[model samples]
Target: MRYFGGLVHAIGSFARDRSGNFAVLFGMVASVLALGVGFAVNVSQLYNAKSSLQGVVDAAVTSTARDLTTGVIKEADANKSVQAFLDANSRAGILSADQIVLDKLTVDRTANTVQADVHVDLGLYFPIFSVGDMKRVAASTTAVYSDKTIEVAMMLDVTGSMAANWWAKTDKIGDLRTAASGAVEDLLDNNLDPKNPRVRVAIVPYAEAVNTGGLASTVFVEARYGSNVPPPIDAPVSVSLTLAPDKCATERKDKDGYADYSPDGPNTPRLDNDGKTYLAKVNRDDHMKTCPKPELIPLTADKQKLLDTITDFRADGVTAGGIAAQWGYYMLSPSWRSAIADAALGAGPANFDKKKVAKVAILMTDGQFNTAFAGGRGAPRSQNAGQKSRSNAEGICSNMKRDGIEIFTIGFDLDDPSMTMTERDQAKSVLKNCSTADTSSLKHYYEAATGTELAAAFDEITENIEKLAIQR
Candidate 1:
């Protein structure tokens, strides 16, 4: 009986010895397996989410960059479109686009790029997993392909009043030259263009009267001595050779010695936005023959001619922007390429050639147009008519735009005019219709009350140009 009891006890002992050890081993194995499964689920979900949404970001960004500077679309509204695309398509692939959360989207105006940030919260199934959450952050590729040259035309105001401290602390003439040349250097120094043509610049200095170069000096000079056209006209100032006999004189002997050929003539001509006069019966299309050599002197060139030309600029005469605007139009007119084949500015025509180029003019002025020939070759003396001149100049600039020459007109430091407010307002009205550039690009037209503002304005414009140059 005793022997039988000992056998049973040994069997019980063996069973008890292994029970606790088996339980411990099973727990350890289960915990390890649980963690492995959890991490696998999290990693797999995150990887799938990133792969799917990365495509979404790329597509959205590429689409957004297309019309960045075209003005075809407004920015605020465009950004909303981008945001919606990213957010709506956030959840898209195996893990689901919804799983990938959109954080924010931004469109940079000056940089011309679209960027988006997002993250995915990976959900894994494992109750005993050590960490409950896993996340992955991602960013979209920056998309704005900038690789084009910037084109610039510096149109400066060289009026007589520019000699006066008309623009705040600075005089008009010096101020214009300083501002203009500075803007030029900014473009060249930064090398705005990443493409072959590079940023090309032209300096157009003008006043009440532009320097009329004779054909002997510049090809733009028309046959003067033989032709009936008199020397360039000057601004209308109160002089001894007046148009009216003065309210004080009634002798009516035509004492001023200037011919009165019916001052304003029969009708007011209707010049369209492109300087195309529907009423002038005379075709001014030949005006392209008037583009002067412009004394190349490129500031961007390694030589110093451009700097010399700018320094030599003198402020004289009244403000006659009409001639300035007209020539600006002609310089960019493709028709002139043939006319200037041998002229100093012959290359100008090619540079502005229509078939293979985009033409833009930047015209800056501080005064209104007050002198236009009406009664035929003399000062307008009857009643002091300034509105007509302003209107005509406005018409010419506007017409230039219609004619396909992109114009950027700057109204810089305009002072109170000698004429009524109506005349001043009439002149101000011209700038609104200036420029063939898209409304979006025209935002670059800057008004500087102070010199610092002028520099900043220039910087802003160049920055924008750099961004959009990709498509030049």
Candidate 2:
């Protein structure tokens, strides 16, 4: 009895003592500290997971929206497209694909938007306090998509140098054909609503001059200045003015050349053959002329016609980039719609409004712009063709850009060992200065060293165009 009572008394005393109070308080504080640390850790993990999920979802939504806009997939297939994209890229981030659960996908046709909501049950590494073992991390993204009309004028170079030598067992022109054809196909294929096409492409192949083809008589100012053919019935020929042939069109004399004036305003001047200005009408199919065999095809949604035209492209004459750029502008210029009425679509190039339509010009070249007409005199194959062509091209491009035309320029084989430093620089300068500056991933200027790079560049440009069409 005495021993048991003494033990009870000692236990009571120890329990009532305040000497161990500090240790007890320390244990409680330590537990709270551990819980706070765990909570912070879990919160950090969830934040990271949420951020990663949002990125992936944004990308998936944007891609799916593009697919919908391009008519690559229908409304019914949008969910699948988004899910597939999520699956492919989900693992690319911090979270695995399996962790992500696509909660819902909404395709609002009226709004032309694709919105995706996704969530992930992230297993907590440290479950502290009253919180559960897992937390839900969710993300939702919306991308606006629309089939805004797109008009692209591709200014391709068919200069003699493009066919000069073989690289990678194929000449530059051959490579150009392949690259250009592929780009056209990519742009026009599976065109949403063929009858009311969303995209139209125009090919403007040029060398020493742009072959006006059937429209030559309408747009070209024929030779006539007391030195040759008679002037137009309405307009009198200037006595001081030299004359040019009616085969191919060259740069205009004054500001009208750089300006995107209608054929009704001031007509384009004809190209002069060699040093001799045209005194009278010459054979339209004269092989001695600097005009390329391939004529400019205005904006059309017909994919086959475009492909055929590109396939038949032949390299000839010297580079006349300024004249070609001018024609490219004309193709997209709404004022010149009547001039190209027969060749282009019923609507022609859509009004130069970025909101209603996207007008893009793709200027490509393999060498320097060495050919130009001095007044009405032809200056073909000039070793020192000054900055005339480049300056004119830049001026025309500036006008196009001011009118909301997005320009993309490509320089193929500019790094060729055979080219002189001056030649390469001049060729690259015009292309560089012509392209529009872009804030996105796609650049407006591309330097393609080989055919493969050329194809890749075109592909990238096509992607840029598609993205450009999609807003928000």
Candidate 3:
């Protein structure tokens, strides 16, 4: 009976020995629950921060990129801009402290764009179960930059008619000077490089003729003299001092309607002295700060000299502008520039036609060329292009002006002297069409009878040029 009582006590003691199993089971279940809650809460917060950071970076980079294209901001400025943007967003609580960092930033000036990579770090927020502080990282960003120069040319008319109020306005010549001076100042103000020799100018002065009359005339005449006068339809031939290998003297008409003959030297009718006024340079303080060397030789061929020549002009002669137009074309033609480079007659040939540099020409006149007056008596130009000295000055200006040269034309004071607008419009049309682009690149034609309108015409032309420089 006693042994049976001992067995019952042992069974009761065994049932109470479950302490180790309960502890193990409770620990496992607690660990699993904490892990699931921590993952769900912390991971979701990290993901939300990452998305917000990406949105902020996208906005910042895009804003900076646009500024680069206008030449306002540079590639070097891009990084600073991006950093500033990020800082602003962070201050707004769009980002966490010390959580944002620049992963990488690259600036490429050659391509004009800046590229940036950004990183964001997230910290654990919920502490329901303090397993550990978690780190969540996300990457985002990009920004871009741009810089470009415009091409420009100044086409000016230095024709004689521009000097006198030949068209009835305040001296067309004065108007031209006013307009061109204004243009240069505007260009300088707008950042054009006169020294860079990039922005160039070509002055074309047309009259009854283009007095290659100075040193050029001296040389050309000595080499070129005609015996059998070209027909009245052709450009009148210009001769030096007339003295045929077998003839007597060279006779020229004076403004007073008298003919004097010269056989050479100071004795006969020297082509050097005309009965009317002579060509002289007048570079007053008003001119564009007299250009440098080779370009400042108006004692022969300058804006002033050309203007003076225009002033000295006589109405006795008919216009044979084609020859003058041809010469102007030659001035801006690559082939001509190359050929004349060695001729080196008027100005410094260097700046005139540097390799790869652009060429330009301006043709201005008031007449349609009905006659060509050779310096001699009755040896008039034939207004005829086929047989004469190529009476097609308009055609010459047209053909060559189209290639690469920028051309402009001004028809002053004539009310359809050619009997129709077609003749006048032809050259002007060619000029306008051959301008650099479409609008600012073409030529301008102005008609002025009163001084105010003529001056206004000049102002209008200059304004167009200024507009081109600014736009370009």
Whole-model alpha-carbon lDDT for candidate 1 = 0.50
Clashes of 2: 0
Identify the runs in model 1 with alpha carbons over 4 angstroms from their true place.
1-151, 164-169, 190-196, 212-303, 351-356, 374-385, 415-423, 436-444
Tens digit per residue, CA lDDT, model 3, 1-472:
8999999998878667669766787799998888788778877877777777787677777767755543345566777877877777863334665556767767666554566678765558764555456564666555543333222233334433344543533455555555544434432342323333223333334333333322132211112332222112222344223322211111122332222121111111222232322211110111111111112112112234434433343322334444444445444433333333344543322232212333444444554444232222343443343223222443444465445445445555656343477655543444344333445454355555544555565556555543333221
At residue 387, candidate 2 shows an lDDT of 65
Backbone clashes (count) for model 3: 22
What are the Cα lDDT values of the candidates? 0.50, 0.76, 0.43
The candidate that achieves the highest TM-score relative to the unseen native structure: 2
The order by descending TM-score is 2, 1, 3
Q: Which ten residues in a row have the lowest lDDT in candidate 1?
A: 245-254
Per residue, candidate 2 scores C-alpha lDDT tens digits across 172-262 of 8889999999999999985867888888999999998887765564443434231222233334356423334644776644321222222
Q: Which of candidates 1 and 3 reaches a greater TM-score?
A: 1
Model 2: CA > 4 A from native: 1-60, 74-113, 117-138, 144-146, 164-170, 224-247, 253-288, 343-346, 374-386, 438-440
- Looking at model 3, residue 43 earns an lDDT score of 72
List model 1 lDDT by residue over 1-472, tens digit each.
8999999999888678887877888899998887788768767766776787788877766666644433324466656666666777866675554555557777775665667666666554443335655555475666773323344555666666667564445655666656666766655654322243345565656654344231112211112222111122231333212221111100000112221211111122333344433211111111122222233231133214445667777766555565455545544544444333444432434343333344467777766766533222244456242443454455556665565455666666544444467655655666655544455544635566555665566666655554445543
Best candidate, lDDT:
2
